[model samples]
Target: MSLARTLLDSAATTALVATMALSAPSARADEKVSIMVGGYEKQIYLPAKLTEALGYFKDEGLDVELLNEPAGVDAENEMLAGAVQGVVGFYDHCIDLQAKGKFVESIVQFSQAPGEVELVSTKHPEIKSPADFKGMSLGVTGLGSSTNFLTEYLAVKNGLKLGDFTSVPVGAGTTFIAAMQQDKIQAGMTTEPTITRLLKTGEASVLIDMRTMEGTKAALGGTYPAASLYMQTDWVEAHKDIVQKLANAFVKTQKFINTHSGAEIADKMPQDYYVGDKEGYVKALDAGKAMFTPDGIMPEGGPET
Candidate 1:
């Protein structure tokens, strides 16, 4: 071939390569979103973990990071400080933040039923109902936690006042176990699979199944409002597409979880998350599934209640 023809062919090839590169889908830097979880290895936040493990976030072109923290006030503070783009926990905290002029919004509802929380106590077996809580020292995650709110609501519903019982802020997870064992508090509110473990070990007995209580509707309306994906209103507005994509991914993950068995869900989870005990994980998953909503939409009054 002539030198001029060779040069032209080379130029055409380069141009074609450039065009293909430009046409191909690129990684969306804006799609990277950080989410804070209530606690590590808790079944309540399983949907977020499942979404990450199942590549649902990646499927939606979002790079999601899950940050596990204590709960309520701490999570809200982190989100307000911009350490996390969103939070997966009680919606009431979001409402509280909003009331404080923080301007937060819930994108999805993870748990509609109060599947995990319970007022458990081996020390007070006679305390079968909320009325018995008077004069008792109750354990709570923190002052602004759903546990605290529920405890107060339960007390009020039982014709008692907030100060009727003393509430000690026993942090969630291992800390709660320690507090219980040390008898730091008489009764406490906690979630599974910790609750499951606690019951299995006989460390505590459920005094009140908040799940069956009528006050649950008033506290969180009819929706349990256990956990959700919340973000600052401004941040959500700035990244509307990314937010929608993330919600879509969560919805997909939730559907997948609902259709599949617990063992199947465990198989997809990391060894650390699943802990090699399929049966236990399955049971936990079953419990968790009951709380999950198939659709990602936040239930009405979830934020306000």
Candidate 2:
């Protein structure tokens, strides 16, 4: 087996054993944990739905409700407003929230790369690079999402000021595809299977690919860990048992991803997630599966990157 798979297996088994030994009161029977996932259908956040489909949550004696929100920013808001207990979204949000005096932490570091691609509409071939993004409308999941952050960072790195281009919140999936099709945006950053959908249609071509560690380092200079299961620190402190259970479930799911074939993992996902192209979805997952961390541990120097 691969190192990642071995580490993930070891971590999952260790966590389960540790949680089982805990003497803290078990989760309240009446309490159902709700997690809001940002674009759960997107392969970047697949573990959320996959874990649910695999019945890992129930196996841990936890009633977990998986909610879907297309935008990570909105998911963050829901968690802050108490609508959800946790968010399966970008790890950057935890850092962003911390700057504003909020305390949230990533309990499970899902992926070491952003799994995002900056695609330029095929109609705009003149846009060769971020340097050409001046006056362009860039699509992001939301105004304050990690997509937006990366968009701005790219723009600045390429010598473009924030005012030089507009950041449009076109959301993801169908809406994101719609924006590109209708020329609502010239270039945008998004995750798969939206990236695959757009590329398959020849509507967009990649300008910057952050979906893998090498691509991420080339674009952003180092490993930029993205998807994660993050919760408010206070809530985590008060619900150690529940947090431990969640960690166990997600770690197992990560191990599964590390070991299984793309088609095998696809079988565990919702049929609708295939977006009418099950084969394409499987192909895309296989291409980008390396972005996921095998051990559910944050990559070394990832946060600093």
Q: Could you tell me every candidate's TM-score relative to the true structure?
A: 0.83, 0.91
Candidate 2: pairs in clash: none
Predicted candidate 1: what Cα RMSD to the true structure?
14.1
Off by over 4 Å in 2: 1-30
Worst 10 residues of 2 by lDDT: 17-26
Give candidate 1 misplaced runs (Cα > 4 Å).
1-31, 210-221, 274-278, 300-305
Q: Report the CA-based lDDT of candidate 2 relative to the real structure.
A: 0.87
Q: What does the lDDT read for residue 152 in candidate 1?
A: 85
Which lDDT tens digits does candidate 1 get at residues 1-305? 54334323322322332233222343454556788887757676778888888887776677888887876668778888989899888766665665465666667666666654665667668677778888888888888887887888777888898888988888776788878888787788887665766777788987655442254554444656667777787887788667667667777776777788877887877776654455776786765575676665444444334
Per-candidate count of clashing residue pairs (backbone under 3 Å): 1, 0
Look at candidate 2 and tell me the lDDT of residue 185. Answer: 100
Candidate number with greatest TM-score: 2
